[model samples]
Target chain A: MPETNKKVLILSVNDEDKDIVFRPADTLLGVLRGKLGLTGAKPGCLNGDCGACTVLVDGIPMKSCIMLAIEAEGHKVTTIEGLINTKTQASFIKHFAFQCGYCTPGFIMVCHSLAEKQPHADKAVIKEWMQSNICRCTSYQEIEEAVASILAEE
Target chain B: MIPVDFDYYKPESIEEAARLHEQLDRQKMLPLYYSGGTEIITLLRLDLIQTKAVIDIKAIHECREHILGEDYLVLGSSLTLTQIEERNAFPLLTSVSKEIADHTARNKITLGGNICGEIFYREAVLPLLLTDSLFVIGGPQGVKILPAHEAFQQTMQLGRGEFLIQTLTRKDFLGMPYMSVKIRQQWETGYPLVTIAALKAKGEIRAAFSGLCSFPFRSKRMEDELNRKDGTLDVRMDRALRHIPAPVLNDIEGSAEYRLFVLKNTLTDILTVWEVEQNA
Candidate 1:
């Protein structure tokens, strides 16, 4: 055991830099939900198969479950809690995109990143990007409609 | 979350990383190189792999190299699949990477991580194999460059304390007529039933495959048979099928027979499309 196992991570979550102690093996999702009490990013499948733990790291959508907390030390992590009064949220509300809501945070995070990164995303591009998250509670139609409605703004 | 605690080091240079790995191995620490950490996190949570030290190589400059050289394209191992796809320096690679996982996972799954991953469906290596790219490996003996064909046999033959830094592919093969197709068992996202990558170079077709056998491979014999000028497309394909490198895989995604069936159709389609391009 080397002396570098425990680390004090200064993570920039939703634009605020917070300090916390974490082990090298601790995942970002665990630290966020347990230590920070930011439970927006749901933990559905610990595996990367389900994108239920997706968050934006440096403006890129990344599954927090698959990412080590220590790795996010210098990057900006934008969780679902970070988003407020955005077009994506408004569109999701108007389109009735979510049901049961277990996967909404992850879906919203991915959708927000997509809208910010590729605002003019076409049908094919939208399908490709949004395929990252899985929402089994409701039909994919409403979710796609929500994303499409926001992308239409650009 | 992973059940065990391990020391993590982010080395800024390749030599420092190699030295750290050697030191950790010498101390019986069971050191492992960490990149994207996607597969590592998943496997660690299941207690499938254990390590006392993790050397994070993502900070190394060499592992972050992504450049289009004068005659080659140098891509670092730590570059995420989405980054590669967005750059589109290599169309065949972009196509293969686009189908590896979903977009979010790709944002985390790095090139080297996928190539040297635990999962068998290493579709990202297909294009590198087709182009005979150069694999830059860093180890205790310093850096060594080997052709991808030589470095990869069923899987990357990396020695202890050795890690991939980046891959170099000749620019000539970058723009070659190539086709990358991954046929999933059910939908567009799951593991491939059989993924085929074909590149037409020097008026001859070169090909590689994944999910067909136990490991991804580029069979010279199969390519030779497929490139034979005397036989019709069917005849050549039948002969090429005889040269499959190993017994086809029979896994939950698909049975071996079904995989071969899909593989044959895919190979035929690729050949037909390339033939039309050649005629045009």
Candidate 2:
């Protein structure tokens, strides 16, 4: 039997910070949703296309599904569930940015990443950066407006 | 969905990685080396590639250095586009890399990964071609310096076992107004219809077009036309437009005629911008 062991740091919205040993076969998304039970980072396209499984690895936005768990051993990981702040939550509700709400978490995660990095980004730059994430509900206008408003406040 | 089960090894040193590859040498254990899993993960999901052992080269420190010399800029294999953009050492290359996708994808995707993957319209390759870059490849035959165009052509023929250690580009070709245009439905999907990259040095102009051909190609006919003694672009522009290949790439997003039309229009627009800048 072949064995490979690697340490991984799993950060979730849940109160516990779990440090687990993983096999190289396990992906970062697998560890987050399967082992840790934090499914906010939805698994829409596991091949890094849908942007559903987006997360922040060491303060940088990344598609967790394509990343190996072992590669994120010592890095700080932040997920959508972890981004629920009072200000952000208030802005999300005021704008009514979500329709079906299935894509809300991904959008929020991306927004959080952007806001943290470039809080003063203009409307056009935000739209350009958010182009990587697709919203099937066609509710991008409101979402973009809401994000712009939030950035304006900052 | 998780990828197929495979033994994983993280090698901290290049010698260890080379030794492991030598040991596994075409055995039943199919080995695929990965720096960042952006493209490889998709290949795994589609079963386009199957591997028994996966070598993670992220931990190799030697493959992660970016050395800027007086004459050339050498970027290690593990250096991500985000890192390059942050440095802003190569302005033209940085512009092309930023336009590849959003910052998220740029953070994980590495220079060597895209080069070794050999996908059409790989953003890094375009700037590298424009700058006449060279690739330092580490293979069973030992380390060798390969011209960027030749390396890309050879990689398309042979599978990516030979590791591309670093990319080298001439540093003196800086401060030139460089532009790259990519036509796509969305910012981050399939290949572009046509991409035009141009560089202006003094009175001489160098430009190349890709995404319409089987591979990224230089428009020698177009360059020759620009070199005429008349200094008037009217006839040269006509000749250049005539030399553009017909029946442009008919892919999932666009028609062949549409691509060709866009290609010609884009070339004209870029040349016009260059002419205006030169006059100014």
Listed for every candidate in order, the interface RMSD values in angstroms are 2.7, 3.5
Any idea how many clashes model 1 has?
A: 0
Tell me how far the alpha carbon of residue A14 in candidate 2 is from the true structure, in angstroms, after superposition.
7.3
Listed in order, the DockQ scores are 0.67, 0.48
lDDT of 1 by residue, B1-280 (tens): 7999888889999989989999989999899999998888888889999898899998898899899989999999999998899999999999999999898899999999999988988889999999999999999999999999989899999999999999999999999988889899887898889999999999999999999998999999999999998979999999999999899999898899998899999899999988987889
**Candidate 1: C-alpha RMSD after superposition:** 1.3
Which digits, one per residue and each the tens of the lDDT, describe model 2 over residues B182-254? 7875555546777777777566667766677656666657777866657556667767666654335777767
lDDT of 2 by residue, A4-111 (tens): 443454543234467765657778888888877778888886766667778778767788888877677667787777766645556777999888877677777777
TM-score of each: 0.98, 0.88
Off by over 4 Å in 2: A1-21, B154-160, B185-190, B219-222, B229-248
* Alpha carbon lDDT at B8, candidate 1: 89
Listed per model, the TM-scores of chain A against the true chain A are 0.95, 0.86
lDDT to native, each model: 0.91, 0.72
